[model samples]
Target: MTIMPNNPPIFSTRKIDLFVPEREELASVLQNGLRYHFVEATVEWVDCPDLTQEPFNLATSGLCGDAVISEISGMSYLFPFMESEFQYSIKRIIKEIYNNFNNGLIIGASICLRLQQQYLVQLGELIMNASFSRITEDDIEIINKSHLAFLDETTGRCALESITNSDPHCYPHGNFFISEGKPGQVLKVRAKKRIGLQFLTALQYSLEKKYSSGIYPKLIGLGGTFVMKSGRARHHIMPYNWDNNLTNARSIHNWLHYCDLDAPLVAVGTLLSSNLVYKDACKFSDLEVCGLTETHFHTFSSNGAAGGHFYTDLESMDPVEYLGYFYPARIFNHVDPRPSCNELIDFTDVMRLATI
Candidate 1:
């Protein structure tokens, strides 16, 4: 008498639905000027691994935390901010979970500091050195007599006085409606819209046609957050920062190989900007994990490896032993610096063959 077969469900019950944008629909999309605002989230599938091991933190558990988890490549990410918000709402909830998490396996995510081109060329050289050292030559002759061409009609006041005197690579790149102060207290300065890679490849082709037919419940993991400027005064601007290039780490390894999602992508930033963009996008792709925060390994003294894991406080972790020690698939090809007790017995034999 022999009959053996009945497993596949170590614990699986996942659902995280979040779509925020109300406050009069974000003040009518910023009074119709529309810089960019849209947040949508939907997840359903429940068995229960402590809801992906106690995730939701959206910075001090606000936007209804406990579903927004993180791990990265060794795979273990739920989604949503660790912290920071207010009309920038955790950078639009990390760009709507990196443009709608494509169905299954997404190891190591986090690439969108507005699609980092050296953090938008150091935020356009700090807004052209704060508009040429806090502008004034009567604020470029009241912006070239408000004729508004922004300059260069026979060297428009010598190209607005040579961009406050030389070397922003000798100015001239069109659009420059600049301004400063001392005339009824003017201010103006624009230059913050730079999310093109053809708008993240048409937002991953409309989130792969709204999750084609997996309906949504397999984006394994993802993370990212950065917003620096910090010269300091009363905290002059800083938010989970990090920077590194090589064309923004090969455009996050070519947008995770153009979303062929199979899972892992983490870069929560800060704590040395998520270990320098996860060590420069693992020197061009092959990143299975790098979700950090043991104060980013004690502020970078270093010691969290096995692809890198340290979620010290994603609101008190332990979602079924951090997903039974990062489920398995051989710990997404573990790099080994740590994590070995036979990889916790191959992550409890891949959560007992995922509770078949």
Candidate 2:
């Protein structure tokens, strides 16, 4: 996936396991380049907004009454916020069985948008890997005031921070030690004798070896909770949010191209927030609070789509699932605006597939 201004690149990362498929589709889409207009012709997916917690009362629009289940991909779902208006016309329900290739894990899917035949295009590189959201006042404070600190890699303990006030405990970890850096005065992440000095050496060495040819210091953080902003005379922290740009729709889709989502692929086009964490398609515009503004936070809206390693791990025995993340998109690839009348396997009755 290619990254552009105002859009963050979403990437799924996994432990270095060469056995897994190599990451091929690294960069894909941009923000301004995106155009979305919902049409009933978009009848494929809609979690009818009729639930109690909903801010808008959509029931009056003749969209309420009766909770229903949508059976797809050999599974069932019921979003109370939704109603019977959009039921999958049970074309034909038959008893069918197959092997649980993913060991009961929820499978995820990569969305194929009908817009512009987008999936057919070539993958591009991300020009910038930083969040393009309007940097907030709070974000500036976190960057300028040294609110973030790195942990001791070994003990994993303030581990270290840029000396802000007259904290005699920690020495100034910078190049010029001036209030702000000059044009080319780049500040390096340094640890005091008391801090994780050993860790500092290892971290710098590791980053140098891994990233190779880069003179700039890296800003590291886990989600939106913690941040470590590297200071450079010419550098200023704009704004970065994990939910906003951790991964994009194409990153995970590209990565999952070869791998089988099986059951754990429960939400790819939430492709994911790890273990080759994929950010799913159509997830861009549907979040309540996307960690950028006060409205919503997260990439996939699936609890930020980073549900930890359990749902991401390939061999994870207990993979979890979360429905209702995608608004206009359905868990089932084909929504069949007209419920099926033909003979189809009944996903709800798992026992039917059982041995006699």
Candidate-wise lDDT, in order: 0.18, 0.16
- State the lDDT of candidate 2 residue by residue for 1-356, as single tens digits: 11111211221111111111111211001000111110101111223332112221111211111111111211111111112122221111100111111111111111111112453321110000011111332121111112222222344221212212311111110000001111111111112112111211222233223322234222111101101111110001111111222132232222211211222111111111111101111133332111100001111111111111111112122322212211111111111111111211111111112101
Give the TM-score of each candidate. 0.16, 0.15
Per model, state how many residue pairs clash. 35, 40
Error of 2 at 145 (Å): 20
Which structure among the candidates has the greatest TM-score?
1
Q: Which stretches of candidate 2 lie over 4 Å from their true place?
A: 1-44, 48-311, 328-356
| Residue range with the least summed lDDT across 10 consecutive positions in model 1 | 228-237
Candidate 2 residue-wise lDDT at 285:
30
Q: In candidate 2, where is summed lDDT lowest over 10 consecutive residues?
A: 172-181
Candidate 1: global Cα-lDDT? 0.18
Using lDDT, give the best candidate's number.
Answer: 1
The count of residue-pair clashes in candidate 1 stands at 35
lDDT of 1 at 251: 27
